[model samples]
Each structure stands twice: as C-alpha cells, then as structure tokens.
Target: MSDDDAERPLKRHKPQHEHQETNVTEIERSPDFWFDDGNIVLQAGPTQFRVAKSMLSRHSSVFRDMFSLPNPTSESTVEGCPVVVLAGDTNTDWKHLLAVMYPAICYDLTKPNIMTVISVLRLSKKYDLPAFRKESIRRLRGDLPSKLEDFRKLPVAGWLYLGEVSDVQLSRTIALAKELCLWSILPAAFYGLIESIFNHDGSYRPVGLSLADEISLLKGYARLTRLNTEAPNRAWLEAESPCVPCDDCLFRTLCRSRCASLRSTLQAQQAGPGAVFSGWDENWSDEFCGPCIKAAKEAYNDKQLEIWKQLPSFFGLPDWEELRKMDLDAGE
Candidate 1:
C-alpha cells in the first residue's frame, strides 16, 4: 500500500485498547434513570432521548424470549443485563452479510445500540449467561460459512467466528455442508468434509450432533493433520494396488463408480496396450435448448403477472392477452 493509504485512521464505536471514560449524564436529572455500573448511561434529548439505557432493556426482552432467557423476573435484571462488548473493525466486508441476517441475531433490538447486542454475544459465555451465549453462538454459526472472507480479513472477528465454529463445524460440516471449507481445512479435515459431503449426497445432514460436537471434531482433526509430517498430495493409500489390479478394492470401486469420465479413460487405456492415461476434454458446456428457454420465459412472465396483479390496481388497463395481440400486430 502507498504511504498515503497506510496513514488512514481506523474508526470504531467501541474504543479499542484505549479505555475511555464510561459516564452517563442526565439530560433531565432523575435517580431512577441512572444505572449505577459506570459502563452504561442514559442520554436524553431536548424533546426525546438521543439515547438511553432503556435501549438495553429491549435487548433484555429479546434475551428473555429466546424461550430460554435464564431468569424472567424484573429482579433478575442485573444478572441478565449485558456485561460485555465485542466490536469488529469498522472496515469489515461481510458486515453487509451480517446485517442481512441481523434480525435473527439481535432478536428485536433497535438500531441505536447495536454494540450492546454484539457485547452480549461476546461475553455471554464468560459470565455464565447460558441463554444469551447460546443465542450468540447460534447467530454467529448460522452466518459462519458465508462470511469466511470477512472472518479471515478481520482477525478479531475471525477468531471469534472461528472459536464459535471450531467446535461445531467439523470435517462433516466441511465436506457435505455447503462449501464452508472451500478455502481450506487441514488435509484430514479436508478428507473428512469430503467424506461427509460425498457419502451423504453433499448435504450436511444433521445426525443429532450439537453444533459444539461438530466443531470439536474439526478442531481435533485439524490438530491431527498439523502434527503429521507427510505431504498430503503424495500420500495416496490406493498406490499399493497394481496398475490394473483385478482385486476388489472398495476405495477404487467407489472412485470409479462416481466418476464416469475417469472410467472412460480407464477403458481407453485397457483397449490400447502400453497406453498412458489421456485426460478427457473438460470444455463441454450444457447444450442450450431454444424451446426450453422460451418455455422458461413464459413461466417467468406468468409468475410476474401474479406479482403485478397483487400490486395496487390501475383504473383501466389492457388484459395481458390483448397486450400480446398488440405486439403481434405491431410486428406484422
């Protein structure tokens, strides 16, 4: 990067390691409105609240209704109150993706104090708030795979996203689950994800394992792959078999069955003595069908007609059939 780019200032709502004063001044002084813990304060406006701790109360309701909020009573407020704040760097790419599914994460928390929701997520576990922790984990994990680029770019957010996933998104999730491990999983974890995805029709079918369970397996497998000294590419278990073995090997058989083009190459090799493996042409595209495209367009127009009818009605309009006839006449 140029020197000019390097000097750009980083901005964030929650200050970084530099701790600033946490004070709540009363716009209209009232004892009941003040929260004793210095971490949060109420801000009032000329005619309304510029901001308020009452915003946190909204987080409290969502915390409660997750259907598992720990304590329901107003007296339970202190323990249930959000106790930590987690913020990602301001320049995150996938914050767009995060915001797309924000409603699910923060429940019904309003716009003013989103950091409160993030803070609740980050510290819920540390403070023994099981319900909030679970909610946070669920939200983070749900968006984990799609936001991998974002996670990797923002190390702090990535670490938190990783910690959230390291236990639940194992090899199985890596393989059969959407391409979550597209970037990388340790080789064994790579194989495991392959096994999971390929073995079960490429859907990460849930087999009653908790998210935590899946992540634990991925972490364990990652550790194992790291310690092994062997090169992943050169380590082929199928190499011991004869070049043209008649032996019934399950691995070889499965590989051959799933890959039709490879089988065709094998047949070509057998037919020509002393032949080397010639790779099949990879340049074929699905043959386009003019009729199918036309049919699809018609179906799409029909669907659009339904959507247009549902919208506010025009006082007078030509029927669709009449519009088509007009087009035909115009062409003629």
Candidate 2:
C-alpha cells in the first residue's frame, strides 16, 4: 500500500449501544457561523467559520491529507459536521485567507494591501498552497527589480513607494527574507528599510527595528553616504578629453553643471547609491561631449556594479551567491 493507504483506518463494526452513547455527546455550534451548505466548521480563537472542505482541500495538500484522516470518536462534532480547531492561527488571518479563497467576499488580490498579502502568504505557506504562495511572492515583489541592471534603472520614487508601505510590513519582509534565505529580494527590501529608518535631518530613529537591525541600517547608511559623496570624483571626470575644448566650451560647462546638479540633488534627497547612479543616467546623459560622456558612463557602470555586489554585506547579509545557494538547498 502507498503512504496514503497506510494512513487509512481499518473498518470495524461497533455495537449499537456504543454508537448511541457516542451520539449523545453534544457539540455547540458557533453563534455567528451559519453556512447551511458548508460541510466543515473551523474554529480559530473565538471565531468560527463554516466553509466547504472541498474548497480548502482543492488548494492545499496539507488540508487534503488532514481531511482524509479519520477523526477521533471523542472529538467535537457539531450537527453532522466535523469541528477542527486551528489553535495556532488567528481569526483575522483566517478571515484574510478565506477572503482570497472565496472572491465573493471582501478581499481582492489584485490590489491587496501589504498586510493582506502578508497574511495570505503566511497561511498559504503553512497550508502547502503552492499557487497562493507563489502569487503572494509575486505581489510582494511588485515593481521591485531583482537584477542589478534593472535595479539601477529604478528611481528614488520607486524606492519611496516600496518604503512607504508600512514599517510593520517592511520589518516582516526583512524577517521573512532572512528566514527563507531569499537573497534576490534583499537588496530592494533593505533599500526600503534604510529609507524608512533614516530621517531627513541625518538623524536615525529606531522605528520598528531591533537593536541589531538598527546597527545594520546605520552601517549601511554610512556606506551609502560615502558612495554618494564619492560618485562624482571618478578619474574620468578629471581625465583629459581626446576632443580638446576651451575653458568656456559649452560641453565642458554642461558636464560640470550636470555632475554638480546630480551630486547636490542626491544629497538633498538623501538618495541611496543605486538612486545616485540612476540620477546620473537620467539627468547627466548626452549633454556632455561624446568622449566625456562615454568615459563617465563607463566609470558610473563600474562603480554601480561594485556597489551592487556589496549590497547584501551592507545590510549584514551573506553575499548573493551564498544566499542563492541557501535558498536552493531550502527548496530540497
């Protein structure tokens, strides 16, 4: 027999007197839970939900195996339905999960808030619901790029968008990423965390961070500050151009103006290194002489890639390759 068959209970004849004694035990139905067609009652905390067993079993392998097992004779039974008490989960989380499972209700996955998505993700992972889990991951990764090149292209506004989501959500995302060894999402997630923690006057606040997390953010902030300050000091910026120009040449003046403008803008905005590089690309291109622009581009690209590689370390995480391998092993 297969593993499923091994778990199946052997059929046995029970005396009428014993069966009648079992039926005499009364199980109270929840006052608010009244789904006439539902086959099962799930109690989480004080809240009860009368939902279809097939609906849950269809989406979750864990639930399918659980429902397939025979219930103990002494367990609570309401009416003809089985009562499963989910002690570890909260009513709010169950409400959110069921909302997603049944679209006729209030939850809409298309435009889910950070907490809603997180709730779904947590429950889905617990229940072994692969599709729900994947969807939650995708929504959480929304508009955030994983690749170095793509991340470099994202503007300060994009980082702000991710950071502005809620301190609680940012904290949870960081914790979950650490737990799952999801390194690919860490760069953008940490960028959001840094933006949320550091204030405008250069002072830092603890916000939702623990002491260790605070230290990591401060260290990452210092590194980012150094990168932003040193970005314009590349050797090529001062290197002699092949196309010699006068002191008052428009190209020379424009190049200097653009560089200073970007540096000041980045400082004023308290932008991260990635945003600083993106600022250069967006605001400093094509205005300078061809040779000067080419050299500057090469320097910026090299520095940006270097910084990208060190991003995980800035947030006190293992390097990208190590994180990738860790996640891969976790899958097995």
Among these predictions, the greatest TM-score belongs to 2
Residue 57, candidate 2: how far off, in angstroms? 0.6
For candidate 1, the lDDT comes to 0.30
Local accuracy of candidate 1 as per-residue lDDT tens digits, 149-261: 33224332223332333322453333322221122122223333323332212234444444654554444333323322221111211234322212333344543333344
lDDT of 2 by residue, 1-45 (tens): 234423432222122242342332342344444578888878666
Clashing pairs in 2: none
| TM-score per candidate | 0.22, 0.73
> Ten residues in a row with the worst lDDT in model 2?
9-18
Q: Candidate 2, TM-score vs. the true structure?
A: 0.73
